[model samples]
Target: MMVQIENKIILVTGGAGFIGSNLCEYLLSQRNKVICLDNFATGKTSNIQHLLSNPNFTLIVGDIRNLSDCHKAVSGVDYILHEAALGSVPRSINDPITSNDVNVSGFLNMLVAARDAKVKKFIYAASSSTYGDSEALPKVENTIGKPLSPYAITKYVNELYADIFFHTYGLNTIGLRYFNVFGRKQDPNGAYAAVIPKFVMQLMKYESPIINGDGNYSRDFTYIDNVIQMNVLAMLTENPEAMNTVYNTAFGDRTTLNNLMEYLKKHMSQYDEKIASVEVIHGPNRAGDIPHSLASIEKAKKLLNYNPEFSMKDGLKEAVDWYWNNLK
Candidate 1:
């Protein structure tokens, strides 16, 4: 049995972020009352600005690191889609303490508040980085390697804490181990920007986009709509076995950086022919970077009936159109 996800109150943490904002928008469209809690550290106000006038939307400008904020956000919430955290492995490496504070400690704060509020479920954005140093091809839920970076460590810790919360406190939690997610509203301007949007923007300007490695590194590259679908499925699923477990939220396929560049250039050329001429530069491999990352999404499929609607190629085309129309 699946719980209907309409006309309920949902709290989306980091609601102004790329993934969070999209979740907020989707839940609102479903007639669910939405409370957006964000510190705007990495999240942008513009992302949720359009929803500000909606009667069902409420914005709480707060940090997850603050327990009071978490408590306040959960006061009347039915479910929580926790997307608040400092992303990017390099940023975490540069400031491990701050990352730990936000990703780990702040996560604890939200869990405590959710447990106290007795929300239906606590669904959070876990990461592919948790696979870490393992040379695994298709990462399964139970098997994992030692974390390779500070960011990886924090995300893995979140899974551990979520499991503990379920067992100890009777708090139902679902952790979605997201692969390389990308799509609309994904910011292209940032030192830590995701590769797809960043590359699209760079190519749009006829500037050469740099690949961090030999251009052979690959990722599952799940789309935002697919991610949103997984989140909704996580919320609606009444399967007892599905609750209190982690699932890989991905499209279950991988694309190399070189192939990704070709896809982007091919799509962008429709708007401007010059985009195709833009060269892609290959540089040395990035630190704490995995060579190839893929997901075995069988768990999510069998348990939640999660069917991803977008392939990497299909999503890239959609995302490129969005960036071209909005950013250009």
Candidate 2:
């Protein structure tokens, strides 16, 4: 796929991680000079080792928490795609201080660097967790509830800081509030892994995936390609209204855990028929987990002209294919 923007130097902060690595590859393929800054905390080296040989791609082994590292990474960069942060809600619950330091303090450092360096745009990875305690079915960008966890608090803080940076220092910014994103290169081994990859891996290994809360809870499961489209749109959008605001990056549909499991099992069964027989166990609901999440992508569609290409099932099949060829 052709990346929308090219020839300009772009900085991706978590470029060794799932989403960021993909972004780096896409940008490089589009003939952009891409700089990847990663500390590799949760990001894996293997994810980006393929790009080290690309002449247009430069790798910076650094952390966003450090202002100097941010400054270093931002030098000569035309745009910033800030994807670095501690992502999981449960991980934040267990270690709020660390999550705050990386997601909050680190974000501030990057903004300062971008402002100081005068980057053309500062786009970032926000979270659907920002919807928080709100009972709204389809979450809009403006309306939000009190954050339910420290991770959510940190993400909300990122939006607040970005808004202030735009208002105060005139740093042009766009925040993409990502829903439950899943696809190729996503981590499925860790304890804080997202549901789809974790479940996919389990089913592949013939292990039962534990469903937290009877598999009724649902999410606005988004694909990585959709997310990449959002970042590209955010970066290249000429609309004045699109700047300094947030957009929900999602496929704009909801899928229950039961349905998600059924889809995963069905797809994985094509590769290994035994996978369909893998039982799904029910467990108590996880703390800090919302019952349901759905996003109104109308904001993105209206502002950024976002047209997500993959639905849940389409993305699942692609992801299953990737895991089979790569991991299984």
Provide the overall lDDT of each model, using Cα atoms, as 2-decimal numbers. Answer: 0.93, 0.93
Please provide, for model 2 over 1-328, each residue's C-alpha lDDT reduced to its tens digit, 9 standing for 90 to 100: 4237879899999999999999998888889999999999999999999899989989999999889999999999989999999999999999999999999999999999999999999999999999999999899988999999999999999999999999999999999999999999998898899999899899988999999998889999998899998999899987898899999999999999999999998888988999988988999999999999999999899888889999988999999899888987
The C-alpha RMSD in Å for every predicted model, in order, reads: 1.6, 0.9
Clashing pairs in 2: none
Clashing pairs in 1: none
- For candidate 1, write residues 1-328 as lDDT tens digits: 2224799999999999999999989888888999999999999999999999999999999999999999999997889999999999999989999999999999999999999999999999999999998887899998899898999999999999999999999999999999999999999998899999999888988899999988999999999999999999999988899999999999999999999998888888989998888988888999999899999999999999988889999998889989988999
TM values, all candidates = 0.98, 0.99
- Model 1, 8: alpha-carbon shift in Å? 0.7
* Runs in model 2 lying further than 4 Å from the true structure: 1-3
